[model samples]
Target: MSWTDERIEQLRSMWEKGLTASQIADELGGVSRNAVIGKAHRLGLKSRPSPVKATDAKLAKPAKSPAAPKPAAAPPRAAVPAAPRPAAPPPKPEPRPAVAAPPTPDGAAPVPKPDAPRIVSIGPGGFIRQGPGDQQAPIPPAPPRRLVPAKPSPEIADKTSLLDLNDRICRWPMGHPGEPDFHFCGEAVNPGFPYCVEHCGRAYQAQLPRGTRRPPPPPPFGGPRVR
Candidate 1:
């Protein structure tokens, strides 16, 4: 609604009296609170404090009185002394008497003492002992062993060269290559072998019993020597 001169005058009077915009709007019909506030602002009417803020200030609780300083703690009291106890009596000593042996009758024979025990040692070197009247003879060194001569290799009269080699012919190599005598045994090969019966005998031999076998020779000082 338009702000007529009378309505503007009434709004000014209510605002100056500290009445809210809503209250002024109710008094002047056909106008809203916003319109009244706008009219007041144009007229340069003084602004009023908010009613909500005023009510909050009135209802706010007052600051609590600084808690009375707690009374100072009471001072500690002095401790009392305890009575002294009596000492325990000393313990009595135990008795231990000396023992004596009975005297022997006349013409009686003296008792004999036992002989010292002998110490026996057993290991890779063999059994040995040390004691009086327990002497052991020195062991004799083993005798030198004689080696049996090896059988001479069979001579292949009809030697087979590499070109003439076949499944049915002996393949045993003889004499080093690059030599005029180098050749393979020409004899018929044994059933399942690539060499003749004589060559196969040389190729495979029965293993000797463990007791009759010789120990391997020691390696050369610098390293192993090629044969």
Candidate 2:
């Protein structure tokens, strides 16, 4: 619907007066709520918070009326004065026992012992302890670990094995042979490699860049050669 100058002014005024898009749309003839919203947005209108919805309790309550003023209460009676009481004398304080000081030669004062190393309380539920001198040479760092290459499993070479061997299963030894959990990778072999894509990458890490083009292997003697 076309927005005339009069309709646009009315829309701006109603929007400024806190009317919702639906209400503005209803007020403006031949306009939808979405249309009003779009026009308002294009006009860079500031958005107001949605008016609070009226609850059933509020809607059900009747409007309160002003009540008639009540007559002022009679003046309160004057209180009778109480008689003054005689003040009693304060009791004397008892004498405290004398402490015996350690006797030193020539009236020299006794020296206090050195305090033990303290654990100081820091921020919420935290504590800081005074460390012993040198603290055991700051714990020498561990040696750098070596990445040993995965060895081929001897079980893959044996033809009498019960485990069903496939051309796809990765034959690399996974962990230490002495460990109970030691196993071989059984993932599908990558094209032109004995290992899977992952193990092939690991096996040829220093040799080649990944995804490099390679010539296909020659076909078997009895099979037809592929171009």
lDDT of 2 by residue, 24-129 (tens): 9888868898899999999999977655445665777899989989999999999999999999889989875555566789888866433455555466557554
The C-alpha stretches of model 1 lying farther than 4 A from their native spots are 60-72, 76-227
Stretch of 10 with least lDDT, candidate 1: 149-158
What TM-score would candidate 2 get against the native?
Answer: 0.23
TM-score on alpha carbons, each prediction:
0.31, 0.23
Whole-model lDDT per candidate? 0.80, 0.74
Question: How well does model 2 score by local distance difference test?
Answer: 0.74
RMSD of each: 24.1, 31.8
What tens-digit string does per-residue lDDT give for candidate 1 at 95-198?
Answer: 64533434458756555434445566665678565455566787898998898854433543356777789999999988888776688878999999998999
Question: Relative to the unseen true structure, what is the C-alpha lDDT of residue 99 in candidate 1, on a scale of 0 to 100?
Answer: 38
